[model samples]
Target: MLTFFSLVAATLCVSASDSTVELTTFNAGVLAGVPLWRERMPFLLSELPNSTADVLCLQEFWLETDQLAVVNATSDAFPYHVRLETHPSATPPCDATPLQAGLVCVQTRCPSNDSVDQILCALLEENCRSELRAMGQRCLNCLVLGSPNTGLLNDPLSCAVDTGVSYSTTNGLLLLSKIPLSNTVADGYNIATGEIDIYARGYLSAEVENLGTVVCTHLPTPNADRLDAPYFGPVEFNSIEEQQNAYIQQLMNRYSSKSPLFLMGDFNHGPAIGDTVAAEFPQVYQNVLDQGFVSPAETRVGLCTSCLDNSLKSTGSANVFIDHVYVQSQHASNVVDAKRLYEAVLPIGVPLSDHYGISVTYGIPVAEDPIEEWKTAFTAWKDAFREWQKNEEEC
Candidate 1:
């Protein structure tokens, strides 16, 4: 990590015409609240300011302490920030009512949402595999959704041993910008059932003074079978690829008028699925591109984002990228530079988070005449000097 002084120097050195602003997106991993977090979080905070990012988007900031920690740490550099409240506004499918037998069907099976809810509750009680099996198809449904509610309950399943501690913490999106922000909007996805129902998965957007509309969000991880996944609600990342796309599209349509849009976050799914994957599986990156967002071309600087998530990492062995920054295609020309902040992780030789941060630079255009502006300034200075001289002579 560069020193704060070095960060300031770098910021000052960038050209005026380009007007480079560093935008960084990182997943704080604060939800886990693991022992490593105690050490890594402070270090992570110290390192960020050193990068001198003009805007920072963070995901998985579940706990109030985690939110406060980031604010306290970066308050000086990023005077403006918004931590989206986790209270979901969308209507939950099961509002204290049991899921009807045939109400929620998946793969031609009538597995009640209540059964799934029961299985989730049982898992919290630390139910064994045999016990979970007894919970039946609903448990199976949980498995299909991923993680079998292991990380959902109080006594997480063995599979979630690593992240069990974090299960209790509530995570959401955070956006911090050096520039003043206005017209803030935050909302959770519409998924009100299964594993995704527990947490608020949504996007946050705000208008920056110089920059266009800036947004930060974290999409649900791709399901085990994208083909069979339900096409309903914003939370479930199953077959409803179009629904997710629509959510973002609506945002762009609503906010693009105020400013060119810049979206940054851990989308959880991307082109990493590979071109060979089934045509039915949703291609999130391609969808974004179709919506007129421009992702940076493959470059050495844009390294794999999911180094820690073995399951999601593109390569089974090596790390691959899932986090991203996208500019509204119409504003792509203003993009001065974009790259990953690969060094933001593990300053003390331990992992701060599974993913490294990424950054982008934008050059907002402004009409100006350098020579004439200088002449005008010189004329004003000369007049002021003469006035001062006359006043001095009178004295």
Candidate 2:
């Protein structure tokens, strides 16, 4: 009896120790023109030393120097792991460089398993090659069709050539952890707008031994303009609404099976306003919400304020909430506390990235059934929406 009790206690202790969450903020796209590389990267990383997040997902991360500098700086503190996805626009030609051969590293502290890292790296490289090929194919098709707007084909390909085929890598999602990642899948979603191609984004699912699944994604920003119009209806991409919806639909469809999911990324839209994608696409948000997912920041602080400064402001709008962290409802119940981390107005003279970062701490509850919770939440939300529709029609 004593032996069994001791084992149980030990297991509990280990679980408690592993159940910590930490998130940090780094000014990813800050550096310019090499030389002072080391100095440039660390400055941004230093922002998160206090939080010491278990997983660090940075945006605007330069593929060349910034990624390496981050690995060096954080090596001593978090000896666990690190992974990076550079911007698609920055990638060089396939023949010019090894696929994903840039400085982006997936640093981890698991037992020395060359096969594992090799496989993961190979997967990353293959995905990059596939994406580039797809982009190139699209460009070539556009050129052959003789559309005057060869801008898409010319600009991205040119950028790829100039930046070494690895520049502006879009899916810059990283997974850092002390736990071992048992399995991973990079699911790509095709985002379209009224049959016109907008972009493709990917969702990365990493299974951590006993911790279940963690999904990382970098959703498309509202930058892909289908036309000269400034905004689509009240939102930026109304014509592409169906495409965006399809993408989200695909995401939900693929991951719904993975109950107790934890999703983190730059959603590029917020729940604060009655405008924007989250607002315009409430049904999509509702679908996720129905599927038992909850936005940690939204639940904790209601809505996050604009994280952008004037320099990062491409659009003139003052109200914007672009970044997000959402967890399954069952996962949210385990969550003890959650909040937007970098709310401090930039120090008098210091320049950070245009967007602030968010951090949330979750406490896995003792008795939570993820699957059951998801079904209930989703059904309730769907029913409510149906009733709302009925009221609107009658009115």
Candidate 3:
């Protein structure tokens, strides 16, 4: 059997020969929090073979022992290195919990003595045990939200809410790769204020060597406003917007002059692509475009409203492209084809996640084009995508 370390070595070898790489992003849909959609995860993983991406960024991935096992089994084809976001809370319960209700999972098959099962088990056990224990403790604390009691009560149901529930955590984001991840950092972005508040949202960044730098992020959702907004609660719009812009600015400042950069994630808002409240967040999307970044999925798909549920009448109207993958303009020559995967299709066997996955392919030429570099880039991108489809069939 091919060991995990060997898979990484193979990817490095492949990287050496290729001038361009493809980056794919997906919102795996909160795996652990919602039990109903859990079974459909395997089919989602099977859909995106490792051969299709050098790096895969996922949003809303809840990492736990069982969920990690499914990831390991489904991702066997892509043997590569992987990385996950760290928790944001500094305190025991919150800090001990994984970052975001969403956790980012990245993998790159490399050569090693550790079997896939062994490595996966170790990582899952460590992460799941810590997170679950923290969550259990938090649930215990939330029981006292409005109660006058200060000490731990003997009855667990004494402070329970109307629903008789205490704690609730959701999946955040994930990143998987076929190459090693360097300089990984996780921070949060408040869309309302555009600030990198290490307390809420989480961000992860790393150098991909030949691929320059790739950053994976999971921003705060509007759900937070329901709890804190005044009229509706605290509309974290400003904070969320500010942080989104800040993250882009930080990326440009750090690597603008070095190499190409790609930022992928679930922004939780739909800009001009669709008629949604999120579409109003022009500042964030503008920053990305201004930074010489283009969203391949948006350019090709055009206002994707893939998220649908038969149970609802507004199924089609709810369509919007919230998930995205951005690539630098200079590297435009390498793009082969860019489009969204799993658009309207429900996750695996069930309606798991609320969003779909987006992907983009790039083909670096043996020689640079003297003119119309984009034309050459598109041609190669098309060819690469075809090859990818063929590989998927074989797999």
Task: Give the runs in model 1 whose Cα sits over 4 Å from its true position.
Answer: 1-16, 33-35, 86-171, 191-196, 224-227, 231-243, 272-282, 297-302, 308-319, 344-348, 369-395
lDDT of candidate 3 over 70-131, digit per residue (tens): 35754665454344423323233333224222122212222233222222232223333333
Question: Per model, how many backbone clashes are there?
Answer: 7, 26, 72
| Higher-scoring candidate on lDDT, 1 or 2 | 1
On TM-score, the stronger of 2 and 3 is: 2
TM-score of each: 0.63, 0.57, 0.56
Taking the tens digit of each residue's C-alpha lDDT, what string does model 1 give over 195-231? 3333446677788886777888886544433334454
Candidate 2 residue 119 C-alpha distance from true site, Å: 35
Error of 2 at 279 (Å): 4.4
What range of 10 consecutive residues in model 2 has the weakest lDDT sum? 142-151
The better candidate by TM-score, 1 or 3, is 1
TM-score of 2: 0.57
lDDT of each: 0.56, 0.46, 0.50
Error of 1 at 394 (Å): 42
Which of the two candidates, 1 or 3, achieves a greater lDDT against the reference?
1
Name the better of 2 and 3 by lDDT: 3
